[model samples]
Structure formats: C-alpha cells, structure tokens
Target: MSQPGVLLDRDGTIIVDSGYVGSVDRVEFIDGSIEAIAALNRAGIPVAVVTNQAGVARGYYGIADVEQVHKHMIAEMARHGAHVDLWLFCPYHPDGIVQAFARRSADRKPGPGMALAAAEALDLDLAKSWVVGDSPSDVGLARAVGAKPLHVGPAGSAVDNVDTFADLAAAVRFILGDGELAMVTRDERPVKFPAARFHRADSYGGAYVNELARAFATVDLEQVSRAAKILNDAHDRDAAIFACGNGGSASIANHLQCDHLKGVRNGTGVTARVLSLSTNVELFSAIANDLGYEHVFSYQLQSQARPGDVLITISSSGRSPNIVRAIDWAVANGMHTISLTGFAGGAARRRAHVCLHVDSTNYGIVEDAHQACMHLLAQYVRQSRMTPDAVASQTF
Candidate 1:
C-alpha cells in the first residue's frame, strides 16, 4: 500500500508570504517549517509543495524564477534535513499582467489539479493524504480532492467551515496522528472578493489580454484538430452544429455560430450550419424561469436536434446541470458532443466525445482558453483549405 502524502502550500504556510516573493533573496522560511518538514520526512511520509505563483501571471516573475526560488527553498530545506518530493505550481492568474502566465488554471489553488497530479506521479493515496496551507484556497484544494485539510494561520484568513491550525508544526502533528496536536475547528465568514480588490488598473489592466495569450499557448493542437475534423465532417455531411452555455459561454457560443456560418464558409469554402442554443434570450429565460435553468439547453436540444448533429457545450466547471443535461440528451439521440471545460472538468470530461479542458480554476482563464480554442479551430480550417501563398496574405 502507498503511504499517505503531505501536500504543503508554499507561501504563508511554509514560507513567509511576502507578496509574490520573486528572488531567492526574498524567501524566508517560517519558524519551525524546516523542523516540521524534517519531522514528516523522518516519519516516512512523502511531501509535496503545491503553490499558486501569481507573480508569474502578474508580470512580477517567470516560471524560471519560480523554479529558481523553489530550488533555493529545496536546498535550504535539505540543509535542515528535509526533502520535498515534488514541487507543483500554478503560474496562471486570471488578472495577471504577464501574457504567458495570466488566466485561470486548474493548477491554481482551490482546484485539485496540482495536488491530483502530484498524487498520481508520486503514487500516493489522496484519501489518506493531508493538505496544509494558510488560506481558504489551500483548504479548498484538499476538500476538492478528498484530502484532509490543515489550514494554518488565524481563523480569520480561512473560508467558513474548515479546519484551522496555528502553524505548520501543529498541522504536522495532526497529520502524524500523534497526541501532540488536535485539529482546530473554526466558524468563520467567507472570504469576500471585492471587485475593487481585483481592479488593479495599474497592476492588472491588460492582464486578461495577456492571460488570453497565455491561454492560447496551452491549447492542445491535437484536440484542436479533432474538433476541427468533427465540425468539418458535420459540414460535409450537411449536419448542423449546435452550441450552448451560460453567460460568457453563451457569448462564445453565439460567436461560434457567426464564425462557423460565415467565417469558415467565406474563408474555407465550406458551409457549416450553426446555431447557438443560448442565443435566444426570451426562449432560454422562459425555460429557465418556468421549468428550471437546467432544462433550457435540454429543451432546445430535444426540439431542434437531429441524429448526427454536433453539440458544443462551453462551461468553466463542466458540471453545469444544463450543459450536462444537454450532453446526455444529445448522446442518447446519436449526436456528437464536444465540451470546453475547466478545473477538474466535472462530469463532462467523461461524457463528451472530445473535451478541451483547461486545468485552471479561474473562470476567466477557462473562458479565455475556450475562446482561443474556438479561434484556432476557425483559423486552422480557414488556412488549411487555402493555398500557402493565399493564407499568408489573408487576415483571420
């Protein structure tokens, strides 16, 4: 049997949170952190560092910088006889200034991507593991993956309904299941996310634009190709492509209709009959208000879909009842399904024939990825059908 693992958050939990520590010069290990880790090491438990380095996304540093810091951190920990088995970081932030690092990613805190990846690569049991951190996102990560959470710090910093600890030592003691510690419980208010706190015009004005660019970089070319083939085949067979989602996904779905109907037709000489199930506000609202929000997409699919039609559902969580319901109905009716999802991908990851999943927790990051994927699909189709010389001259 694999041993239980310990997932530690980097900043504030093990190291002092100095607001995006950039250089090795800035890294300061919290009191007793080394000793605590060394204790875990002595106990024969594998340890991993799972951190959200927004500095990369915020234009404060690069992935290399993060690695360098980790290198320094690891070396320091080694000097104290503690070894970190893995270091997984989420560099993207939705409000980041760096084009390469900005956007929501599943690797970020509160999402289970980093922890899950570490668990898989390390061959450990998540249900038997423990997550230790300073913020609500840290606790959230543990809960999302079924690991026990040990949130270190004042209870005020935590999200409501989680275990809290005074420091790393206390958390370690609890994880070790010794009599030295007892888990701390808390009754706290939820963390507030004020719009102004994220506004940061000076620090994050074009962060989304950079995030969008970063998101584009993460797109899987093969997945893009698969989606393209599905759409192109549907067009060739004179079948329809229907898209749906809520809010920003709805906007994307609508844009998809426009692009597939006109952009691909005019550019690639192939006509794709496309429609947005989310475009008709009156119809969707009526369905939502009267029947329930979950029934809106399913109602449309049931009414308008035919066998072999393609359904593209865009949602960040991929767990939206309406989106899932739509996919379920489409599959039963012999339609192809493609989903663009984020975070842990929810249930849609398994249900869709093709899933373009962003491993980010930020909604904006996920949407940016989905939007970029859409553009890539359209552009690839437009260019693939055009002569190289002509493709060079055309603006898509």
Candidate 2:
C-alpha cells in the first residue's frame, strides 16, 4: 500500500493572512512554505490545496475571480519553487450574502465535501492523506475523511484528531522528513560505485564520470523509438509538442527543439510542431514578476496546450515543482506527458503518461543519458524518413 499524503490549506496555512484574497498582488507565501512543499513533493507525497473562500458566497468575488487568485497563488509558489498537485476550494457559506450561495453546501468547510471531491478526482487514498490548515473547520473536514489533520499557528485547544504545528514549515518538516534522503526509484536496478576509485581523488572522479556514462548507456533505445513514434503521430495530427526543463535540462529543452522541430524531417520535409517552454527568458521572468515562478510552465500549458498535445519534461532528480505542476496540469487536461528523469521515479514519473528513467543518482550520468535519448529519438526519426540522397550522403 502507498504511504499517506499531504493536503494544505491555501489562505493562512501556505500563504500569510489575506482575507478573501482575490488578486495576485494580495498573495504572499508563508516563510519556508515553498521549501516545505517541495520536500513533500520529493518524498512522492501528493500536495494539494484545500481552501475556504467565503468571498465567493459573500458576492465580494466571483468564481472566475477566485480561480484567477488561485492561478496567481500557484504562479507565486512556482516562482518560489513549489508545486501544488491539486487545489480544492469551497465557495459556499450558509450565511452567504448572495442568495445563490446562501444554502448550506456539502462542499463548505467543516464538512468533507471538497476534500472528498479532491480524493476522488486525484485518485487519492484519503485515509493516508493529511490536511494542514489554520482553522478548526479544516481540522474537522480532514477528520471526516479519516485523514490526518495538522493545524498551523499557535497551539489551540487540543482537538481530538488534529495535530498542532507552530508553523507551516514545522508541519511540512514533520511530514516530509529530512531532505537529505533520496526518495522515489527511477530504475529498478541499484547503481554501484567502485570502491577502489574512492581511494584516489582523481580515480574516484574518473570512476564517477564513468559510472554516469554507463548509466546513460542504459537508456532503452526502444523507448526512445516509442517516444518518437508518439511525437510523430502527434505531428501527423497537427498537434503541438511542449518541452520543459531547468538549468542543464533547460538546455536539453532547446536541444530537443532543434532536433524534434528542425532536425527530425530535415530532408524528408516532415515538420513536427514543437515549442520549448524554457526558451523565452523574458516571458518567464515577466510572469515570475507578475504572477510568480511556479506557474511559469503551468500557465503556459494552460494557455498554449490543447487536449491531445504532448508535454515532454526533463529532470535529473525528477522532483522539480514547476515540471511536476506542468505534468499535473497536462494529465488533468487529457494531454500526453513524457518524463525523462533520474533518481527515484518522483512525482513526475507517477503522473506521466510515459517515463524514461535513468537509474543513476549522479546528475551527470542522468543528463548524459537524457541527451543520448534525445539524440536517439532524433536520429531514428531522421533515418526512418531519409530519402535516397540523404541516405547516400550519410553513407560516405
């Protein structure tokens, strides 16, 4: 059976106090919240947002306004380097000022409606999930689903089922444990480093390099082929392919753009429509400034990605919040996702439609293998569609 997971309250738990936050300008994250959530993500625990927005019921804001605010919140978290897997909200209030929202709804706080809905929608094991909030109602709702209810802020009168935390960071630390331990399994096989190499600095470095190389060598060529086929099929249907990564992986995104968009059908004249989300630094920074970083990829996916499009994500650790959020969005929207990852499978792997895993924990090895996979896909596509002249030119 899978382990228990984490659910978070958005307003006061993750973000600081903001009454009925309806604008991006109003959203501010609690200190260490991003790191805490990221740690949870690394541990393969799904992190969701459960919030009560009484503003909707009060007619102070509409559903769209609430969604926009959430988008801003997500964007901010992304900028800060955390990802929210799912967001569940209750807009109803029994004492709502608006007649339309005046009735008592199961989705309202103190009830488990939204949490239950999130459980069903996200395929979560409610019994193993935790809900972190700053209010008694949040605690009650979590307990209703048999989930762990952790309260943030000052120790309140002890509730039977709730655990009190000094802050969000403290709660997250308890839930995620230490960040030093690697979580998730990328490849089924264990990686071995040579003991002799460790004795000599130079030899150890070389051995480390060699081990990485060997790890890259294990990336299945057939899987690359299958991924190429998927991309090709998508191309045939005139669908878009979106790629994302960070740092070195971001470079890989550019490389993939060159290969998939330009190199694939160079001589054969077949063009695969592709875009690398990491390319535009200006837009990224702008969004980070205006919206926040976490939403950089997700917002793009929401705007540019269509149903049946392909999303290819690259990560050595397989635990980037932005990438995971993008994958989550893709999955929710019925888009296909291909994940290239190292270390343990991470959240991205579990959520991906197809995962190309690199077994090694060493980043260099994983990156190398990712590059090789990229090359293999490009070369295979090129060769498959090569004309007589193109083949002849390659022969000599």
Candidate 3:
C-alpha cells in the first residue's frame, strides 16, 4: 500500500475562518499554512481538501464561487511551492435557503463519506491517513475513517480529549516526526447511543423518558420561537400553511393542519389557513404511483401553492426524498419553509427556512417530540392573539 495521505479542512485549518468566504479576495491563508502544505508536498504525501461550504446552501454564495476560491487557493499554494492533489467541497446544507443548492449530502463533514471518497480517489489507506483541522467535526471525520486526527488551532481552542497543535505547521511537523511535541494516546472516541441502554435498564420506561428529556433539551428553543413567529405572520397575512410527512410523521402533518386551522381559530381571532398535503391518500398514492414517490409533496405544492405561502415538513430522519423535494419546490416558488426533523436533522432540516429538530436517534422519541412541537406552535399562536381573560376562559 502507498504511504497514508492527509485530508485537510479548509476553513480555520488551512485558511482563516472568514465567515462564508466565497470570493478569492476574501481567501486568507492562515500563517504557516502555505509552508505546511509545502512540507507535505516535499514529503510526497498526497493532500486533499475536504470542507463543507454551507454558504452555498444558505444562499450566501454559489458553487462556482466556491470553485473560484479553491482555484485561488491552489494558485496561492503553488506560489509557495505547494500542490494540492485534490479539492473536494460539500455544497449541500440542510438549512440552506437557495432552492437549487439546498439539500443534504453524504460528503458533509463528520459523516466519513467524504473521507471514503478521498481515500478512493487518492488511493490512500484511510487507516494510516491523517486528518488535520480545527473543529470537533474534523476530528469526528478522522475518527469515523479510522485515521489519526490532528487538531490545529489556538491553544484554548483544542477539543477536549484530542491531541492539539498550535497551527497547521506544527501539526505537519508532528506528522513528519520532526517536532518536540508528544502525541497523546487516545482513550476515547465519539460514541453512538447504545441500544443496550434500553435492554439493561432497571426501568425501560424511565430510561425512555430520560432519553426523551435529553432530546428535548437539544431542541433549539430559538428555532421554536422563530417558527411561532412564522406561523403568526402567515396567519396575519392570511397566507396558507401546508404540511407534509411520511408514515408516523404523516400523522403529525395531518394533526398540524387540524390544530392550526380549527384549534387555533376558535379562541384566537386570527384565522389560520392550513392544509395537510399528506391527508389526501388517493392523490398522494396517485402521485407516488405515477410521478415517483419523491414528487408526491412537491406535486401537490405545484397545484395550489403560491408565493409567500408556508411549507412545513415533518420527518424523523429528515432525509426523505419527497420532503427534500417539497422544500426545494417551496423555496424556488418563494414560499416560506419549515421542517421538523430528528436524528442528525437530515436534508429536509437544511432545506427548510425554519427547523425544529429533535436530536434523538430513537423513532418514538423523535415522533413524540415532533407531535409536541406541532401542538406547542398551534397553542402559542392561539394564545398570542387572545386577551388574557379570553385565554383564561378558553380551553386549548
């Protein structure tokens, strides 16, 4: 096998983390970055850039802009006698506002997908490779691929329990065995929630509830507040709110329409116009049978949705093709989009304008959280418009 290569993270590691850097003019190589790459090149180690460009998904820039920046990076590195063998960037973010660029991708950092790709492309043995970066996600990528992780950043920025270096140059010296620094033996790595936790529990029900509480804490309260405001604004303008989901999530979608429409309308003077795209079983089946399942929600949106409307998608995994397509269509057609997601907040979460994500990997916990989110939004919107006396007198 060939000597192990190095996978580098772009922002903060190779270059300064200029927020959402798109143009070449904004690309600033961190001190010693060029020299570091040159050192790798001199040692005949292949180098590849594996970075996430969520700015594209956020509608701050386009893919071409990212490529342009990379080109500039290559030229700058070349001037310093460094050469990058490959440049790989992930342009998908689940929370992007742009219709075309928004979605989830396997190549995103921390997933090991991009690392596997770089291994294949560079013919490098991942187990012997080094992943150098400045964030926990970078270390996570290394761990996922069974590579040695080298964290480079300011002294205080070191991730706990990981080997840390002052900069890329320092990390490079360590890799080449020319440094006085000592490499720490790792005793810990990122771990997944064990299914055994349920089986070995003294009380399975109590264990489940405890997990649920932890998941609930992960829900961004700020996002929930933002969603409430979106619903409020939609009601104020009389714009329609449409929701869709699959399987367990489908039930939440239908329930959302009912509560937001009838439940929110009774006490609150605000008349909410809501529809569940997943409610029409015949139409959904027809769309699925004819146009493919991915088009089910989006197909319905095309018929009745208009600009300034709202779309709310509920999916536990949030990677459902149909949910992603619906968010894509909604954003493209100038509609406000929201998604309730669980388990890593999949493409639907990134694609939506607002995301209320449940952080649990358990299906039951996530679905229950999503259902609670639906009810909370409906009730909040209702109470916001009602007088204190009216709120006191009315049943939610």
Candidate 4:
C-alpha cells in the first residue's frame, strides 16, 4: 500500500480569493497555510495542490499565471519548511468564454482526475490521504478518490456530512493526532513519447509534414472553436492581442499580428489590436542587458498589458523561456492565451488556455503548421463576423 498525502485547494483555502488572482502581488496566503504544510512535511507526508483555475477558461487569466503563482507559493512555503510535491489545476469550466476550455473536464473539482493522477504518479494510498478545501467539491473529491475529506472555512459548515475545520491550523492539529494532519510512496514511470518515431520514419522529411497533418487530425475541434471564440470576442471587446515567439516562431508571431490586426479588420471591420513581443528591439535589449533575456517580453507585458488582453505565443518547441515568461505575465493580468507548438508540446502547450499543437519532429513542419493555425484564427474570426451574403466570395 502507498503512503498517505494531503490534496489541498488553492483559492479560499490556502490563499484568500480575490476573484481570479493573476499577479504575484495579489497572492494572499491564508493564515496558518504555510505552517500546516510544514507540519505535514515534517510528518513525511506528500502535499499536492488540487484546484480549479476556471479563470483560465473564463478569459480572466491564463495557466501561466497559475504556474507563476504556484512557483511563488512554493518559494514562500519553502521558507516555512514546507514543500508541495505535486501541482494540478483544471482550467476548464463549462461556462468559460474561451471555447477550447468551455466544457466540463474530469480534472475539475467534484471529479477525481487531479487526485487520481497524483495518486498514480506518487503511488499515494487514497484511503489514507485527505482532501482539504473550502467547498463541496472538495468533499466530493475525497469521496471520489476514497480519501478522507477535511472541509475548511465557514462555507463548509453548510455541508451536511464531512469533516470540518475552522482553518488549516486547526485541521493540522486534529490530523496530527495531537493537533493536525498527514503522507507518499512514489511510482517511477518515465514519460514515454511514441511520437518521437516521426524523426526516424522513412521518406521525404521523414514524411514529416504528412505525419504532422495526421497528428493534427486528432486535435479536438472544441479547443479550436474555443480559441476562435476567444479571438473574436477580444475583437468585439476592443482588446489588444499580444503575440510572442523566437526565431521562425518570432516571424510567425509578427505575421500573426498583421493578420489579426489587418486581415481580420479588413474582413470583419472589427479592428483587432495586435502587438508582437518579438519587436521593440530597443526595450528588449535594455531588459535583456539588465534583468536577462527572459525578462524582455515579460517586462513589456508587465508595463503595457491590461486585463482582458489576448496573448498568442508561437513556440515550435514550446520551451522557450522568454516566450513562456511573456505568456506567464500576460495571463496574470487577465489575458486570454493561445499557444501554437509542436514536438512534445512543451510548457507553453500545457500553459496556454488555447493550444494549437502540431506533433512532428521537423522545425519546418511545425512552423508551417503554426503559421496555418494563425491564419486559421484570423480568418475564422473574419468569416464568423462577415455577412452570410459575403461568405462565399470573401474567403479563398
């Protein structure tokens, strides 16, 4: 049997909820949160954060913001002798404006996706673990995974039949046998990438473009539709679209800006505001010289971006630090994010709200597909807004 652990929530449980918190300055840690985790850490218990970041789907923020906040949270916890072993967030919400995430996801609270995945990865014994949060979903999650539930806050008082605590300190005390809580045994399963076979395949570019096309066929259309809706809605709301990338992806980002700002405007008269982070050589050099290369795009975003802006990141490998950092800052400020990536679809692929991924080995194939994705969104928004009578002759 695996060891026990604690699955904790984010907003309102460990941290005070400020309605879609995006910036690092806004992360307010709940009283005793750090100490409670420290208590668990001392007991050799594994800790995992399981929360629903619906803001990512609602266009209030992006997943990069979540990652950045979690990073900050971890650093703060470490200072107090606590460590969170796992992090799981479900960005999807049924009523979200971003089409890609506008559906029910198993990872959402009241569902066991996060707990189950963490359990499998860490070899956690669910029967011995505890679900700690401030909502009914938290209790429901415990039931789903066969873990004990510790409902926190006054809201939990309304719940009929579950363990309740006034705060983390109290819960930890009770769980500790004297005062508060729990624990992991881990499974070492390596990440397997069968898609890597495209690199070794026989024929033209290893028949890579064909492989890319085939892989794209499997992408969920709901995600694309969600992305399209995010773009169009941004256009309607007169929001800015910030795009970032590196190398060929940089060119693609710039080209995407042109298409969204010009093509979409010409086609739909929506006048989408677009900017390319790959541009602004002067400020980019200044930041890269002072803070480091990764700060260039993010610094610009921190100063210029406002809530409800859109971020479009074209990172063929999805691992570029600068690109990822830009997305991180943008999301924290309530920007809707779209990522175009390839290969194993690195961090950006997972962090962005809308992911347009081309699974292939060749850079040329990935960039080509990314370019097509940009055009697809620009044209999609244009066509959606155009008159029915103009649809036939307006597009090629």
Give the winner by lDDT. Answer: 3
Off by over 4 Å in 1: 1-200, 205-218
Task: Please report how far candidate 2 places residue 309 from its true position, in Å.
Answer: 39
lDDT of 1 by residue, 8-120 (tens): 99999888998999899999888778767765654456789999988888888888899999999888765544578898999889998888776889889899899989988
TM-score of each: 0.52, 0.51, 0.52, 0.48
The Cα error of candidate 1 at residue 86, in Å, is: 20
**lDDT of each structure?**
0.80, 0.76, 0.84, 0.78
Taking the tens digit of each residue's C-alpha lDDT, what string does model 4 give over 317-396? 89989888887787777889988888778999888898987755457767887887788878888788888888877753
Candidate 3 structure quality by residue, lDDT tens digits, 1-396: 544889999999999997989999898888778767755654456799999989998988888899999989888765444668889988888888987767777788888888899898888999999999999999999998899999999868988778899988788878866642222212211112323223234335544565566567668999999999999999999999999999999999999999988898887666778999998889989999999999999999999999999999999999999999999999999999999999888888888889998876778889999999999999999999999999999988
Select the stronger candidate by lDDT from 1 and 3: 3
Off by over 4 Å in 2: 1-3, 155-161, 178-365, 368-396
Model 4 alpha-carbon drift over 4 Å, by segment? 1-206
Candidate number that wins on lDDT, 1 or 2: 1
The lDDT ranking, best first, is 3, 1, 4, 2
Which run of 10 residues does model 2 get worst, by summed lDDT? 181-190
lDDT of 4 at 165: 83
Candidate 1: residue 396 Cα off by (Å): 0.7
Off by over 4 Å in 3: 1-194, 197-202
Q: Tell me the TM-score of model 2.
A: 0.51
